[model samples]
Target chain A: MRFDVVGLGVSTVDLIFTVDELPGREVVQRAGESVIAGGGPVATALVTLARLGAATSMLDSIGSDFFGSFIQREFTAEGVDTGGLVVAQGRTTSKASILVRKSDGARAITFSPGDAPELTPDEVRVDIIRASKILHLNGRHWDACLHAARLAKEAGVLVSFDGGAHRYTNQHLSILPQVDICIAAHDYAAAFAGTEDVAQAAKALLEAGPCVVVVTQGAAGSRVFSKDGLDFQQQAHRVDRVVDTTGAGDAYHGAFLYGLARGFSLEASASFASAVAALNTRALGGRAALPSLAETEMFLQHPL
Target chain B: MRFDVVGLGVSTVDLIFTVDELPGREVVQRAGESVIAGGGPVATALVTLARLGAATSMLDSIGSDFFGSFIQREFTAEGVDTGGLVVAQGRTTSKASILVRKSDGARAITFSPGDAPELTPDEVRVDIIRASKILHLNGRHWDACLHAARLAKEAGVLVSFDGGAHRYTNQHLSILPQVDICIAAHDYAAAFAGTEDVAQAAKALLEAGPCVVVVTQGAAGSRVFSKDGLDFQQQAHRVDRVVDTTGAGDAYHGAFLYGLARGFSLEASASFASAVAALNTRALGGRAALPSLAETEMFLQHPL
Candidate 1:
């Protein structure tokens, strides 16, 4: 089946713990509650796209163990196509344990990818890439992502890369030439651009060959630089209570991709994505409280 | 159909996360890994008992939710009897999200018991309680526990209570009179006994009428006090690395009961339980790394 957007990367089940205070050494304190949900940059992004009425597909490898099955279950339940998912025999899939502090929407996360197989270029389905309008990459499987990005570029599809962190080895940077949109965190932008300033960081990243560069600043909003030399700044919608900011970035990235596919201007897309991300911080998890298009519009009209 | 130990309480699926540091305001960090396993004090204790080759039965309420079925699946797979387990409609079984810190063996735990029905006294199977040599009460359903404990006592069966925390309330405390062995954490003992010192806590708790009181001091050791002035202290086996301490206490409780049923002395039983708990810390979850009797004996001999 054809897809609006196809996300290729790792997917995981996140175990979140909400705590009243940071526990002291050798002391036991009770937490408020715990929740389990689907997580991972590409996984959450695809789920968000699906929630936004987009036909999304994910290509990745999950363990054949129970947690792997859980990832698949969440994907299918969320209406994200899992046809491209590979269940490997030796691993147990990736899992993250997240601790959310009650006072603020802050978190400490730990993850283990037990036997998570690395996807190769040979595993990419050429037909699926040709069918998709946009290809989303998280740089998890470098070789596969590079191959897919090149194929998508050649097929006249837009390629968006979510550079989680800039500390990746020089080998990962080699795939940047095929990227059409390079969205990154402030740290990644700074590391790639060699400048700590947000504006300078975006400029440096753009010089790396992307047609558009966007650097996300948590709670501060986002800065976008387009191919036509259009620079715009979008402020984050104010949230009354920030519960957990675990997947805010993923939401922003997914929403941005959706907006771009629907022909929204870069400025409008960033604003819309920022608003959706702000709403996500109102609750625990990255995808739990994702606002619908109607909800997002209403929120824009009467924002908190 | 007879059982050595009958556990009366709730069973849950535990989602455990291990974090590098405690969470702070407006920050995000990745977790190390997530581990899923069977949870709930009595439920886990029963699993431990079954793993140790004891005939164990669980009498509790699980919802008709997916997680509830998952709990039952794990229980049956582990050879624990679930004939008395009640599946309530429109309710989800309990779930626990636990956060473990990397620097220390500290945890923050949260739980959700969605629509889990409380077992009424009428639901107690008198024959089941009478057939068991030890009736283990987790204080989840006070009324049901009281009724079953009374029946077990009348049948000359030893009744053991695992006092989790102050949440059990005074109504549950009233059931203490019918208990033969009362095992509790130091915090639980202080809340129930109104004393902080372990020895004083045990002394004050023994006065509450349970024939024997065992107070667990995390990592320090455990103390057992009897009304007849018999007292003994068992040091915890030194653990080189503690991956997750989620089910250490439950393992100790289960092993203690097993030792008691096997006609071991109080000191020997506590020592055995300490070894079990130490070994449990060497792995993840309460039941995953539970050592066999032979394994425990060798561990104790090696003294690591």
Candidate 2:
């Protein structure tokens, strides 16, 4: 495979501000600190993989605006190839303004969905997907996602799906059959299965099509189930402090895929993935504190 | 005079998001609309003048970041010269993330003051200040503001001081004597005079050395007082809608200065300023709906 993993999703520029409290009325407050960074579920995941020494490629249509430039430059700086990235002229790129409370790490997000059109099915980079060991997606650019997943399946490339929280829908069920590995937030799993039971949700997800299924509940831990009858509960890794939890799930998905590519055992893969997610919370922005392979290994060894 | 007006103040990039209501806790809301615009007291004032067919220039130190580029581009597009604008290498430009309530145009602002160093007194463009018919300032880059005001006075240029609401300080007293025109928000005037009486505040401001003094009250109208004993209350112009009042005061300052430069009488100038300020509130951003000379004249004649 030319690349370890290829991702298709929306990319955005995130401007985060730290404030005393969320405003409930008219007022002007000073930010304690602020940082601007590139953000998106699958985009951040690909960045996580690249930081852990995996070669990854991203495919998406972005505007030619400042935010788009920011997103593209960030990918290049992180060693994530943008050969399949499309630039849409005279359009505004997606951006989000997130305000984080100072006393506690709660956030209020106001996102602007830019005017850039979504990628069409024909816009999918078939060659990139066919050349990758794994094709990861989160149902963004719905038609294109379905097209890319089918193409990856035909080429014998693994298909990974990430079901983010509050993003479950009936349309997602139609694409699950082609997904080889399915990892989802607890809310997504429960919503998809029409039940609150994690075990029942995992069982339903496994029966649908993925050979392996994992449902993650942040801070509590995650449960992994596979068709081969191998099952285990992975404890959440402990961190000295968690500055922000913005992209923790995305980090897990990326690190877990990295583990599978490296041929690690499923149990070891889950543990490594948990550590990577925990470590990502030590900084403000999603990609700011991504750990390298050496750093992750050293952290696992020290267990602190 | 080479230019009608020269401005010395901070310039910022404002990202305004219109939300259903202010967020008081952890929540992710979709913005009804979003706009990114260049903003500042004196910068907007100059842009207002430029839109009205006046030659204006801006002076300030800004970062070589995205927001800085935006500020510079906006000024150029509006026909405002930026020869005195300084670009500080490797610094972040000041920006504000404003969440505006959709029900009413109330807003909550969280600003990030960038790390760019302040423009020093020596950095003030002496030639630009000396050539302009009027030099305008609002105490930004304190030392530079003072230097510019003194140079404008020595060169026989009229000095205008904008006392924005919540922006008054005792240090401003030192620069007041050089000012020929002093326009202030009612709150600012009251703060300076240590009294809320409009007549008394205006009288006190005239005694502080300005030949003309005006105190503005939004929606209610503005009261103008002069050292020559001319006094009048100019009623605010009524607009079809008031989308946002972000830059109304600044617009008034620019149009008032424009009127003075065109040799209009004090009462006529105050009425023109009021009309321009009211018309500016017809759009979402400070500079979005700024009127040109033709638009302003048409609106004034129509009286709606």
Candidate 3:
């Protein structure tokens, strides 16, 4: 199937419990507003891309379980193609119980990865990768991701990646050479570079091979470091109020990916993505306040 | 404010996700049926008691949050008194995300204790605890539980306890001397006794000061030990099949407490409680298949 962006990763069902603060052991708090929705860096980004008028498709082994059903249904509802998806038998989809602090809208998440079968390299649909303009990835299903990256590279398709807190060091970093554009959360860059400084982290990440590396610092906006020595920074859009920042980073990555597919310049896409991220904080989850292309354009016209 | 039983502990909001098996790290499975209910050792017991036509009330710090509101609303709906409940400011309610295995009905639970304020001795409603015919305790809110037990003792009310797993050894063992009737799951008895044998566990628990100790063994019914040297076994009620056993033990405790209040003999109460536990396993959650007193009595007549 022809596609604009094809994403590969686990789509999690996030059960967000809102509380005043994260509790210590043995402490009990009454939960405030609770939300249940599909979440995961690549999953949310794919949803974001679809929302912004991209013909996106998702490729992952969503187990034949309730959570898998929910993710697959949600993907279809969000206009993401499910033709390339695989349903593994007798497996559970990832479920993340996130505790969102009411005051700062910060969160602590407990992730339960169900025993779904791993997506193998053989499962990578060559035709889907070749037909797709962008093959987006999050560092899960390492072998499958590596295989898809290789196919996308051979097919001359742009290999976009969302380096979200990329903890699987060697596995994730090695795939960077095949990645064309990697928009990462600041923490992911910091971890990848083993440095606290954002600039240094971005520079270190660029050295590892993604030609264009963009590091997103929440509320501080985003910065892009290109191998061609083009460095640009975009200011964050002012938010009227922040309700929940749970999925804002992924929204930024999704919007940024959307921009690249739409053929926008680096600086323009960064600012456009920043606008999308800021507006997303007005709602409870990552997909709650996702703006359309026109809405994002309008948001860019007037800051908040 | 007179009541048949007063319970002291949390009314946890349980999010049960059904999977084929317990997941290992980083695996994903598809979920099957999912259920949400107010559950806890004492809470389920109270719910069972209320369903069986007992005049029940509960005392705890169920904060003014969504889950707390849900529990309080459920209590009011179930005809359980909530007049003595405290709405602690800025606290989150206990949420248990349980993964129920579809194949064997086994479950693995991840409990998140939100930062709700602890219920203190001062918050224990002296009048409510005294007015109740029986006081039920679960090993949470240690100070408040101890205070309520003392009040029940002074008022000559029967103090019945449900020693869940009783992992809090030091805090739990001390509460036993103040307890009158103790009904515990086999696991709790084993933990209390630090032995694998059910008889030894029951005997060991009785020595800690509960005059009556009954240990519930799932599918095997129960064995009761009395300080007066009466030890008797009750056969489990045979069911067509067991669906969910989540709160079967609690149902047994609540039924046993009901039997005593209704003036039944020790042996008769054990059998009656066994009937309640057996019947409760026919549905999705603890409260779903809870039988009315008439239904339970009918089951007792048929012995199933």
Query: Model 2: residues >4 Å from true position, as ranges?
Result: none
lDDT (Cα, tens digit) per residue for candidate 2, span A14-80 = 8899999898878899998888888999999999999999999999999998788888888999999
Query: Which residue pairs in model 2 clash with each other?
Result: none
TM-score for each predicted model, relative to the true structure: 0.84, 0.95, 0.59
Better of 2 and 3 by DockQ: 2
Candidate No. with top TM-score:
2
What digit string (tens of lDDT, one per residue) describes model 3 on residues A160-222?
A: 888876453767867999999988888888888788787798888778878899988887888
The candidate with the higher DockQ, 1 or 3, is 1
Alpha-carbon shift of residue A184 in model 3 (angstroms): 2.1
Prediction-by-prediction clash tally: 9, 0, 24
Per prediction, the TM-score for chain B is 0.94, 0.99, 0.93
In the predicted model 1, the residue pairs found to clash are: A109-B30, A109-B31, A110-B30, A110-B31, A110-B32, A110-B33, A111-B31, A111-B32, A111-B33
RMSD of 1: 4.0
Over B26-62, each residue of candidate 1 has an lDDT whose tens digit, in order, gives: 3455557667788888888888788788899999988
Question: Which ten residues in a row are the worst by lDDT in model 2 chain A?
Answer: A65-74
Ranking by DockQ: 2, 1, 3
**Tens-place lDDT digits, model 3, residues B1-304:** 5798999988777876666655433233456765557888788888888999999999988766566777888899899999889997767777776666677776655566666887899989898988899999987888888888888898899898887754437678778988999888788888777898987888888888899999878787789999888898898887778888888888898888988988999999898888888899987776778899999988878763
lDDT of 2: 0.93
